[model samples]
Target: MIAIETTGLEYTYTDGTNALSGVNFEAKEGEKVAVLGPNGSGKTTLFYHFNGLIKPTRGEVRVFGESISKNNIDKIRKRVGIVFQEPDSQLFAPTVYEDIAFGPKNLRLGSMEIKNRVTQVLHRFEIEALAQKNPSNLSGGQKKRAAIAGVVAMEPDILVLDEPTSGMDACGITGTMEILDELNDEGKTIIISTHDCDLAASWADRIYILNKGRVFKSGIPKHIFADEKLIAEAGLKQPVIVQTYREFRARGISRGEVPLSVLDFMDSVDVKVMNIRCAIAGCDVEAGDEVCLEIKNGMLIANKGSNGVTGRAVFDGKKGEDIAVRDVAGDILQHEGTITIIRVPGIIEGGSRAADLDRVRDILSKNKHQKMGAMGTSAKVLMTRLGLVCDFEFDVIQSGILAALRGFDVTILASGGMADRVAEKVKEKKLKYSCFVL
Candidate 1:
């Protein structure tokens, strides 16, 4: 189902500034959509229309197939929550607790129910310590979290965040995005506006490039970023991973699809190694011949001995075929590590699953040299309660894959949809690694 849709959305300011023009957009149920644009683009203006905060001048905005009107404006707002770019614009309550409770109170929910919602959000966002703090005194990241918590307390089905990590540090950005992912896993439609191309490429399932009050392009991140001309025309730089992949491709070092993350890049490197074959005819070297191999001008060059050789390659010959070199430039990854995923229940139900926790403990104890990671809010919170120290908190799936590539077994704790996501990413690597989900 379409959670939100806009047809020919046009918005004009009181000063006659046209903010959006003839824009058509839609977000499916339980999808993560990203709106990317330069400054002064119609990103935020389009977002305001999602929840009736701003009505179009000559278009229509629909939430769940229902047009927005004053009669149902309140209902629309209740189902669509917007977190502005600037938290100061949305946060007005004296204390963080009160600010979060404000939305639930407006719903006419009982005081106890409101309290429970606020408390749950506080802990969910890891802002419990800031519950009594003044919003005005909180840090920029804290304010952002508080504002989002307030909106989430209303239990909206659709979440629209404008520059959700604009002022956050690296750690803050990762934590915030993880929380958003967890919300998305719980069936909320997440729509965010961001200038961070890297974040959009890695996090969003679909992207809309808004330019000059219109959508310039819309597609999956891989296709959207792969177009060099489109990125240049959109006035955006390629994401770091994409840029690196292009450089490797240009240098004849890496091939295959454009990688979106470090883990993907590592997999590409492995594929390149697996595909390298000896080009010289009748050049046969016995095992342990100490032959040297070097990549010069995009071609692999092999020599007789290691005296002048830059690297070593493992040769495996097939009938009537040239010898295939497996490891051309680096140490052969002979023993690929295993990735073990443990799916824990949500935080509220975590305490009731003591057996699961014991199983996790047993797994951890057995894997002495394994790297530990956690994904989703529930798994992180459960690990914290269990006094477990996670080596990878943010980007757990990619981190686990990278660690496994380096021959270290990995144990990842994830919940709900995240466990499946981990499995999907692991399958993409195509390495000889074992993934067991508990």
Candidate 2:
């Protein structure tokens, strides 16, 4: 049976911004498909159409053979559970248990049945300990898990998640993947809209690329990931493994096949792998060396290190008072509001750093407006932490971060050489400023 299907799905905002256009797509029963795209690529907009959260401008959406219309919305909602990109958006009740039980209660389940469903999902997600804690008080990863538990408690057949792994640490991503994998094994259809190429590469059996309200590509991940043109069009980077493969291929090395994961790359490693190879030949030396050569299994054993770029973040509010950043990186930050609209300079694009994105997301989440500043992959992760709405517009990357930084009351730009330039500009403009320097 078709779990979810849409024919020529199209949606447009009140302001006439086209969110989706003629999107024809479907997922089979028990299939795990990752809907990969940049922000505002219509991933979420298309998802909303599935449960009648929003009606399409044209075409139709069906779940389990039933068309999504006002009359069937209540029924559709029961079978399609959405775990939003930001956990905060899904959480409302003060306690986790109450929050989890809300959906079942709304469904009019008996008291005993509601309790059973909530307990089962909480234990399944291993969040029983947080049952009594305020949803607002949980950490970013914890909050994400709780939100998911609440969704799964409904026992939906089709699971739709928007940026499911956003704002999670490495461990958190792995754990969530495992749970999803188990659920899929139990016959659930999983659809996740995300920019986390690594996760999609590892978890999704199929991939769909959307851009500018249209479908750009759809196929098995192997085919989709290898489509260089399609990847570029979608405003995404090739996985790091794929990048490494390209580097090897450029040096006259025959890497018969490019691997998608690091482990796969390691298993296929019969020849030497160099990150930045030397320009000259003969002796294998670090990049920038006068001479270099290659050897089978040749690898540099360098310890993992931080970027060494740190700084104090200070946000100047509307009336002149400054909000100091208590903790730097690794701390979960949040905001709440309805964004009216956003005009960015263009910096929130593909090139934006991950750290820079987290800062922007934190700031946007606290405001209230509908039209908000769109962000790139890096910014998406940060916004995930703050539970803000962001877009992954191709033009945003093309426009440049400086342009993206222009309009915000408080811009959270990264420091280091970049910060130095901003500091210079501030001095030249004689704008009052206060920030912690790394």
Q: Give me candidate 2's TM-score against the actual structure.
A: 0.61
Best-matching candidate per lDDT: 1
lDDT of 2 by residue, 196-229 (tens): 8877876688888888889888988778777777
TM-score of each: 0.85, 0.61
Report the C-alpha lDDT of model 1 over 113-145, residue by residue, as the tens digit.
998899889977889999999999999988998
Task: Name model 1 segments beyond 4 Å from true.
Answer: 270-331, 348-356, 367-369, 431-438
Worst 10 residues of 2 by lDDT: 331-340
| Stretches of candidate 2 exceeding 4 Å from the true structure | 252-254, 271-438
lDDT of 2 at 389: 49
Top-scoring candidate (TM-score): 1
Candidate 2 backbone overlaps, count? 27
- The total number of steric clashes, by the backbone 3 Å criterion, in model 1 comes to 0
